[model samples]
Target chain A: MSNFPPAGVFLVGALLLPLVPRRVRAVALLMPPVASLVLLWILEPGQTLTVPFLDFQLLLTRVDRLSLAFGYVFVIVTFLGGVYGLHLKDVGQQVAALLYSGSALGVVFAGDLFTLFVFWEVMAVASVYLIWARGTKRSRQAGYRYLFVHMAGGSLLLAGALIHYNATGSLLFEPMKGGLGATLILVSFAINAAIPPLHAWLPDAYPQGTVTGSVFLSAFTTKAAVYALARGFAGWEVLVWAGTAMAVYGVVYAVLENDIRGILAYHIVSQVGYMVAGVGLGTEVAINGTTAHAFTHILYKGLLFMGAGTVLYATGRSKLTELGGLWRALPLALGLYMVGAFSISGFPLFSGFVSKSMTVYAAEVDHRGLVVLLLNLASVGTFLHTGLKLPYFTWFGPSRPAAPQTRVPWNMYAGMGLAAAINIAIGLYPGLLYELLPFPVDYRPYTFAHVSETLQLLLFTGLGFWLLIKMLKGEPIITLDTDWFYRRPARLVYVIAVVYPSHLFATTERIALRLVQSLVSASRDPIAALNAATVTLFGRYPDGRMPRRRHNTGDYDPDRYRLPVGVMGLVILALFVALMLWILLAR
Target chain B: MKSTWLVLVVVTLVLTVSGDILTRKGEYGQWWYPVPGFFALLGLLGCMAIVVVSKLLGRYWLQRREDYYGDSGAGE
Candidate 1:
C-alpha cells in the first residue's frame, strides 16, 4: 500500500468506472479521493514510490508540506466535483474528470521532471474530453483549439525538460537556474497559468465546456500551473510584473464580458495572477501566501463555477443578457454563489479577506508598492464584476422574458454548499488553512483595521457599481481579444493557402485538359482541324464577324492523366531515397 | 431599490465615522487611519478607474459584434 502512489487510486478507479453499474460509479468516484486523502495523511514526507526507467529513476510520490497542501485541496475538490457531477450519466465525462484530477495529483506528487511531464500531458488530454463532452458544435471546435494550444505548450515543456536533463545530467525536478531550459520551462508553465497572450484560450474554451465539466476544468489546469511555478520558479522577478499585468488584464476583460462563465474565466486569470505574484515575490511568507491562496481559490472558484453551471443548467443559457429575475427562482444558488463571490472579492469576513490579503501584505512588507497597488485595483475590479455586477445582472437585473427553467439537481447544491462551508470556515478561522502551509504562519487577517479597510473598499466599490449601473449593463455583443489574431487570420490564411489553391488548381487543370484534347484531336484530322484552329486563332468563325465559341462540357477524365504504376513506384522510391539521404547527411 | 441605496449611504457614513478609532497595522499604520473614509475613497476611485479604462478599451478596440467570427463560429 505504501508503494502505491495516491494518484494511482484515482487513475485505477477511473478505469474501473466503465465496468461498474451506473449507481455504483458515483460511490466509486468518491472513494478514491477520500482514500487518497487518508493515504496522504498516513504517508510521511519525501519520495515514497520510485521506479527504474530506461536511464533515470521515476519518482512518483514525493510527500512534503507543499505537495501535501496541494494534495489535500486537490482531493477535496475532486470529492466535491464528484458530488456535483453525480447526476451526470455520461460515463466519458465522469472518467475524464477522474483522470484529469488524478493527473493533476500526479503532477503535484511527481518528484522528477519526467514524471511531471507525463502526468502533465495526461491532464491536458483528459480535460479536453470534458470540453468535448458538452457535445455542441462550438464546444467541439473549442476543444480542438484547446487541444492545439496545450499540444504546443506540452511540446515546449518536453523540449525544456530534455534540454535541462541534457545540460545537468539529472532528471530531478528542482529549482531551475536561469538559462534557455529554465526560460522554456517557465514559458510552458506561464501558458498553462493563462498569463496573457496565452490566456485567451481559458476564456475561449472554458465557457464553451459542459456545465459540470467546466467546474472540473476550472479547478485543475491553472492551479496545477501555479503549483509547478511555486515549486520551480519562485523568486523569478519577471513573474512579478508579468503577474501584475495578468491580474489587471484578466479583470478588465471580465468587466467587459457578458457570459457568466466567461466573466468567471477571466476572473480565474485575475485570481491566478495573485498567486503568481505571490510566487514571484519569493519570500517564505509570500510562497506560503501563494499556496494558501491556491488552497482557498480552489474551493471558492470551484463554487463560483458551480454557481454559473447551476445557472446554465437551469436556463439552457449562460449569457447575462438572456438571464435576469432569477433571484426568486434560485435563491439558494444565489446565496451559495455569493459566499464564493464575497470570498473572491475579499469581503471582510470571508476567505478572500484572509487568503488574498496575505499576498497583498507580503507585497507590502517587501515594499512592492506597484504590485500592491495593482493587486488592490484588481480587487476593486473583482468586486465590480464578480462580487457585484455578475450577481446583479444574472439574478436581479431588469426582468427579461422568463426562460424555461429546469429543476437543478440537488447534488449540485450539495457540492456548492460543501464548498461554501469550507470557504467561510477558512475565512472565519484561517488558522485551519494556515497551519497546513509550508512556512510558519504569523499573519493576522481579522484586525479591526483590516476589516474596516476591506469593508470600506468593498462597500464603496458597491457604491460605484450603483452609480454606474447603466454603464455596466451587459450588451449582447462579443468582446474581441488576443484570440482574434489567430482565430480569424488563421482561417483566412487557411482559405488562401488550402482552399483557394485547391480550387484554382482544379480550374487550371480543367483548362489545361481542354487545350491538350484540342491539340490531340487536331493532330488526328489535320486538314479540318487546321481550318477550325485557324478560325478560332484568327477570331474569325463560320459566322460573319466572330461567332462565340461554345464551351465544352469538359468531361475531364483525371484517371487518364494518372502516372503509370511503375513510374509512380519509381517516383516514390526516389522520394524515399532523397528523404533518407537528407536524414543521413544532416546527422 | 431606493431603500437599498438609502441604507448603503447610511452604512457608508457609519463606517466612515467609526474608521477613525480602529487599531491600524501593516502598511501606513495609524498615520493614514485617522483620515475619514480613506479606504472608501480609494475603493470608489479605484472602481471608477477600472470602469473608465475598461470602457475605453472596449470602445476603441475590444468590443465587437456578437457574430464577429461569422460562419466559423470560432470566437464562440
Candidate 2:
C-alpha cells in the first residue's frame, strides 16, 4: 500500500474487468473507482510514491489537496459513469472506461512531467475508445481526429518535459520557469483545456461518444488540463486573457449548437475557461476557485451530459431539431436534467452558485474590471444555453417527441440521482467543498448581495431567452469553430497526399487497360500485335491510325472473355516497362 | 410554473429595492455595486448582445450543413 499508487486499483481492475464475466463485469466496473476513492481518502498529503527507473525517480503519486480534490472527483464520476453504463455488454468499452478513469487518476497524482506524460497519453488513448464505442461512422471519424489532436498534445508535453529536464536537470512537476520548455508545456495544457482552436476536438468528439462514455469524458480530460495549468503555469497573465476568450468563445458556440451533447460540450469549454482564468489570477482565492469549480463542475457537468445522453438513449436521436416535447414522456430524465441545468445556471442552493461565483469574485478581487464584465456576460450565456434554450427546445419546444427506443436503465437513474444529490449537498453546505480547496480563503457564497446578484443575472438572462426563443430554436446546422481550420483543410491535405496518387494510378490503369486489350487479342493472333509493335517508336501503320484486325483475333472476344482488372493493369504495366527498355537498348 | 416565476420576480424586486438593508453598504469592487438592478441590466443586455452577435456570426460565417464535412469522412 505504501508503494502502490491509487491509480493501480483502476489499472489492475481494467486488466481483470474482461475476466469478471459479462454478467457481472458491468457490475464489477464499479470496484476500481470505489477502491480508488478509499485509497485517495486514506492517502495522506505529502505522501509520495516513486519508482526509480533509468536513473530517474518517477513520482507516480504526489498526494496534495489539489491532486486529492481531482482524484476524488475523477473516481466519483467513474463510479457514477460505471453505474450509468451498467447495462453494457461490451467488455472492450468497460475495460476502456476503467483504464481511462485510472489513467486520469494517474495524471492527477503524477509528481513528475515524465509520469504525467505517460498517463496523459494513456488518458488520451483510453478515452478515445469511448467515442469509438458508439460504433457509428461519425464516431469512428471523430475518434480519429480526437486521437490525432491529443497525440499532438502529448508530443508537445513530452518535448517540453525533455527540454525542461535538459534545461533545469530536474523533472519535478512544479511551477515552470520562463523558457521554450515551459511555454511548450503551457501550450500542451492549453490544448487539453480546449483553449479555442485546439478546442474543437473536444466538442466534436464528446458528442459522438457513447451515452455512458461521455459522462466520464465530461469529467476528466479538460479538468486534468486545468489541474496541469494550475500546477505549471499559474500567475501567467496570458492565461487571464486566453481563458476569458475561451469562456466567451464556448458559450457563443453553445448558443448555436444543434446537438444536445454538443451544446453541453461547448459549455465545458466555457466552464473550464473560468478555471483557466482562476489559475492565471494565481491568488489563494483564485486557485481555490479553480479547484472548487473543477470539483463541483465534474458533478454537475457529468449530470448534464447524463441527462443529454439519457435523451439520446431513449429517443435514439441527439439533435435539437429532431427532438422535443419529451418532458412528459421522460419525466425522470427531465427532473434530473433540470437539477443539473439549475446547478449550472448558478441558481442559489446549487453547486455552480457556490463555485462559479468564486472565480468571478476572484476577478473582482484582483481589480480585473474587464475580466469581471466578460465573465459575468458568459454567465448570462451559460444560463441562456444550458439552462433555458437547450431544455426548452428539447423538452417543450415545437417538435413532437420522438418515441423512446429503449427504457432508460435503473442504473442510469442511480448514477444521475447520486450526482444530483451531491450537487445539492455541496450547494447547501459549500463548506464541504471549501474544505477541499488547496488554499484558505475567507469567502462566503450566500451573502444577500451575492445571492441576489447571481439570481438577477440568471433570471434576466432567462427573460432574454424567452424573448429570443424563436431565434434560439435550433436549426439542423453545426456552427464552425477553430477546428474548421484543420477539419476543412484536412480535405485538401488528403487530396494531395492520397487522392492525387490514386488518380494518377487510375490514369495509368486506363492506359494499361487498352494495352491489355490489345495483348489479350494478340493471344489468338500473335502476328498482328508483333506487326503493330514493330511499327512503334514513332512508327505508324500505312492505314493512318493502326492496323485494325479485330475479326482475326478469333479466340479472344472483349465481350466473351474477361480478365480481372487488377491482373490486366499489372501485365500492361510490365509490358510497357519492358518495351521502353528494349527501345532504349535498340537506340 | 407561472406562480413560481412570479414569486421569483417579486423576490428579486424586493431584494433589489431593499439592497441597503439586506447587504453591506460599501463598494464590493466595481462602480455598479451601488446601483440596484445593475447586474440585472447586465444580464439582460449581455444576453441580448450574445444571442444577436453569436447568431449573426454563426449564420454568416460559422453555420454549415451537417454533411459539410461529407459522409465519406472528407475522403478519409
Candidate 3:
C-alpha cells in the first residue's frame, strides 16, 4: 500500500489513456478518481510513505485528516469534471485533466517541500493546456500569460524550499518561522491563491479555457493553494488583511465583469478569502472552517462552471450581453445552475450555508471585527452578482436574436445533477461535511438567529438586484483590471525582448549566410573569387560582400566547386598547427 | 411579471427583517445587532453602493474596449 501513492493513480491513468478506445474514453476517465476515492477512504490517518533521495527522505504519502480532507475533494471534482466532459472527444483535454488533478492530489499528500515543488510545477504545466485547448487567438495569448505567471510562482516556491532546507537542514512542509524562505513561500502560495494584484491572471485565463476544462480549472488551482496556506502559513497576520481585501476585490470585479465565466472567476478570489482568513486566524475552529469551506467550495464552484459551460457549449457564446432569454431554451441548465448560485449565496438549504458561516463565526469569535464585517460585505456582493445579476441578465433578461442554441448533452446534465445533489445533501445534513472536517465541530448553520441573519442579507441583496437590474446588464465591453499593469505593457516587452532582437538576428544571419557562401565559392575557384572580391571592395562596391552575379552565376556544380586535394590537406594542416600553437601559448 | 417579482422580493425582505428584529440578541451580539433591518439594509445599500462605485470606476478608470490589450497585435 505504501509503495503506491494516491496521486500515482490519476497520473498513471493519464499516461495509459490513449491506449483505451476512443468510444469508452470518458468511462475510462472516471475509473482513476473512483479508485483514488476508495484508496483514500481505506487509508487511515498516521500513515506515511517515504522514499530516500540523496540525503533527504521524500515523503510522498502523508495520510492524515488534513490531507484526507483535500484528497477527497480533489478526486471528487476530478470525477465530476470527467462526467461534465464526458461528451468530449478531445483526448488532450482528458489527459490534462487527469494529470492536473493528480498533481493537485500529490501536493496535498506530499510531506516534503521537494515533493510539493515537483507536483506544484506539474500542476501548472498541465493546467495551462486547458486554456490552450480552445486554440483561439485569445486563448493562445491567455495560455501563455497563465503559463508564465504560474511558472514564476513555481520558481518562487522552489527557491523557498531550497533556502529553507539550507538553513534548517530539513524539508518537511509544515508551519514555518518567519524568514526570507517563509516569506517567499507565502508569496508563491498567494499568487496561486489569486491574492489581488497577483489575481488578474485567473479572471484573464479561466474564461478562455475549454468549457469542460474551465469546470476543472475552477475547482483545483486556487483551492490547492488554500490547502498549502492552511498547512504552512496559518496565523500569518498579513494574510488576514490580504484575504479580506481579496474577498471584496473579487466581489467588486464580479459586478463589473461582462463575461459569465469571468464573473465566476473573480468570485473564486472572493470565496478563497474566507479560507485564507480562517488560516490566518489559526484557531481550531477556523482551520475546520477553512477545510470545510474548501470542500464545499470545490463542489459548488464546479457546478457553477458546469452550468456556465453548458450555456457556452449549447449557445457558442459566454458573454452576458449576447446571452438572454435562455431560460426558455436552457431551462435544465438554469435549474442546475441556480442550485450552485443558491449554494454560493449561502442559501439556508445549500452546502455553502453549512460551510461559509463557520469562517465568519470563527472571525467573530476571534474578535476580528473588520475581517468579519468585510467578509460579510463581500457576501452581499457575492449574492448580488452570482445569484441575481448574472442570472437576471443571462436567463431572465431580454432575448438577443443573435444567440444560438443546441440541446445540452446528457453527460453535462449528469455532471451538474451530481454536484447539485451533493451541495443540497450537505446543506440539509451539515454533518455529512462536518464529519470530514479536520477538527471537531460545534457550529450550526440553521440556528434561528443565524438563518434569520442569512435570510435578511441574501433577500435584501435580491431586492437590491431587482431595483438595480437596469444598471446591472452587461455591456459588450471589457474592464481593465490589475492585469492592465502588466498586460497593457506586455506588447512593449515583446517588442523589446522578442521582436527587435529577432529582427536584428535576421539581418545578421543574412549577412553571415552571404559571407559563408562567398567563402565556399572562393575555396572552389580562388583566383576568380579573389579578383571579384577585390573589385567589389576596392572599386565597384563600398561593402565587402562579393557580388551575387560573380563566380557561380548559375546552378551549383559539385565537381567544379571542389577544392584541390593538396590545397584541402594544407588547410587542414594549418588549422591543426594554429590550434596547437594557441593551446600552448594560452597554457 | 417584473412587478410581481419586485413585490415578492419586498415581502420576503420584510418578513426576514421582522424575524431578525424579533430574535433576541439578548446576551452577546454587538451594538448593531439590536437594530432591526440593520443587516438587511446593509445588504441592500451595500450592494447598491458596490454597483454604483464599480460602475463609476469602470466609466472613469477601468473599462475598455475588447481590443484594449492590443489583442490583434496590429498596431504593435
Q: Top lDDT: which candidate number? A: 3
The residue pairs in collision within model 3 are none
DockQ of 2: 0.48
The 0-to-1 C-alpha lDDT of every candidate, in the order given, reads 0.87, 0.88, 0.89
Q: Can you list the residue pairs that collide in candidate 1?
A: none
lDDT (0-100) at residue B54 of candidate 2?
A: 91
Residue A69's lDDT within candidate 2 is 88
> How many pairs of residues collide in model 1?
0
How high a TM-score does candidate 2 get?
0.88
Error of 3 at A76 (Å): 1.2
Docking class of 3: medium
* Residue range A106-197, candidate 1, lDDT tens digits: 99999998999999999999999999988888898879888899989998999999999889988888888877887888989999999998
Ranking, lDDT, top scorer first: 3, 2, 1
Q: What is the TM-score of chain A alone in each candidate?
A: 0.87, 0.88, 0.88
Candidate 1 runs further than 4 Å off: A504-587, B1-8, B20-36, B71-76
Q: What is candidate 3's lDDT per residue for B6-69, written digit by digit as tens?
A: 6886688788888887776843456676778778887888889999998998889888887788
Arranged by TM-score, best first = 3, 2, 1
Tens digit per residue, CA lDDT, model 3, A26-117 = 89999999999989988888898999999888999888898899999999999999998898999999999999999999999999999999
